[model samples]
Target: MNSPEQVPQDDDAEVVEPARPRRKGIYALPNAVTLAALFAGFYAIVMAMNGRFEHAAVAVFCAMVLDSLDGRVARMTNTQSAFGEQMDSLSDMVSFGAAPALIVYEWALKGQGKWGLIPAFVYCACAALRLARFNTNIGVVDKRYFQGLPSPAAAALVTGFIWVMDDAGFKNVSTMPGMPWVAAAVALYAGLTMVTNVPFYSFKDVSFKKTVPFIVIVAIALLIALINLHVPGMLFGLFCVYGVSGYVVYFMRKAKGKPVSVIATSTDEPDERGLH
Candidate 1:
């Protein structure tokens, strides 16, 4: 038998393993904005503790603006990531949930004992529940409406009351007759409404990239001018109306024999069967 032909292998040729894919690094810009929002919430808490209620309220509002921007920034830059989503949620819990609850409690509810603690705790709990539900039901809900009031808006309603009151020289009104009760009512309404099935307009359909009629731009400008005339009063009034608008829509829909739930009527999303 002929000697088996031995295949000559070049020892000089190095074996090359498949090139490992590069691990993605976390995006910094949006997360930095989120951190700023978190700092604002912490600052609000600190300011409230120091009796600077106006500053605290302002800080919370600042947090709200920053909170609104981070997600849009992430989307615009194509830097969306799971890490960013988680970071955003935690930041919101601070800026919109805990900060407002704590600040409002310090502002007006500190003296009511358990009665005071109840609304604050309720608001905080509702915020947590709302956020959890939002994350779970995102794909099952209508994009045009939130299943409940957004936490930032709820926080706005709560803190907006404080800001308007404080701006009107009511910083010391925590001791005023019926003031704490009023605060409690506002907090309770905001908290309870958050867990409701009422739908709040998400404004997701409003596109900054799309052109609008000139009248709309004019109306926006006019609205800004009006708001600037009395910042606290105007903003508080707007949020107050918004806080109740969900219930208004719910009732209207009910009366019209239309579905009131923001949860979409989709058979495809089986996971949403038992969800409210």
Candidate 2:
């Protein structure tokens, strides 16, 4: 018999195992921003339904800002993941795709009935297609330009139209009898731009780090301030110009026997103007 002190302990039968690692949380800062953007999109839809068109349009813009930041934040923090990409895409479809389409339809297209709804659906469907193509081709395409017009840009064009008209005091513009056809045409153009093969400037290659004159910086700052002050009108005009410019650029390129590319059409470009 063994003494009590020398008694065999149960330790011989027990095996110690390494501790399991803690599971990581999904609520990272960047992802939080993405979620916020998604919320903003949902809110935009709600606001639009409430007849607060301006607020709804602004919410979509806020969503765009948050969406742009989330990716950069993730990249900066080295937290980029497949999950983030998918979430971002889903958020975009809501904010830039569905939200904008619905807002435009409710704010202006409702009066046109089927004529208006068709274009709204077309824009939304095109935006979805554009996003899907962007995801698949992001790495394969040229880093300097987009393959087609971005969905956000198209959305901006539609939303901006409303903002500008509102600002211009065109309260009954949407119901002005003949205006529905014009809205349909605009929507169709925006929708087609997303699927077109037009090459738009990605501005991805431009670097602000290059040495430049102080006056250039001042000029740029002033330009930005002006844009900030006149956001709705300027944004509307900018996108309108962007949409029309594509045709001009294409024709110019054709005349010169050079390949024409649309500006900011692809993810290959950097978000220079904060339009991304």
State the lDDT of candidate 2 residue by residue for 1-276, as single tens digits. 865676555855877799996555454878899999999999999998888878887888788789879988997887777778899999999998998889878877898768778989999999999999998877556656677888778878877777777677766567787666776777778888988877676666777669988999899898799899888998888788877765666677789787553334455553323222
**Model 2 misses residue 127 by how many Å?**
0.4
- Which runs in model 1 stand beyond 4 Å of their true positions? 1-24, 267-276
Output the TM-score of candidate 2: 0.81
Tens-place lDDT per residue, model 1, 151-239, is 99999999999998888888666688899999999998888888898888888778888888999999999999999999988998999
Each prediction's whole-model lDDT (CA)? 0.88, 0.79
Q: Model 1: clashing residue pairs?
A: none
Worst 10 residues of 1 by lDDT: 267-276
What overall lDDT, based on C-alpha atoms, would model 1 receive against the true structure?
Answer: 0.88
lDDT score of residue 196 within candidate 1 = 90
At residue 63, give the lDDT of candidate 2: 87
Query: What are the per-model C-alpha RMSD values against the true structure?
Result: 4.5, 7.7
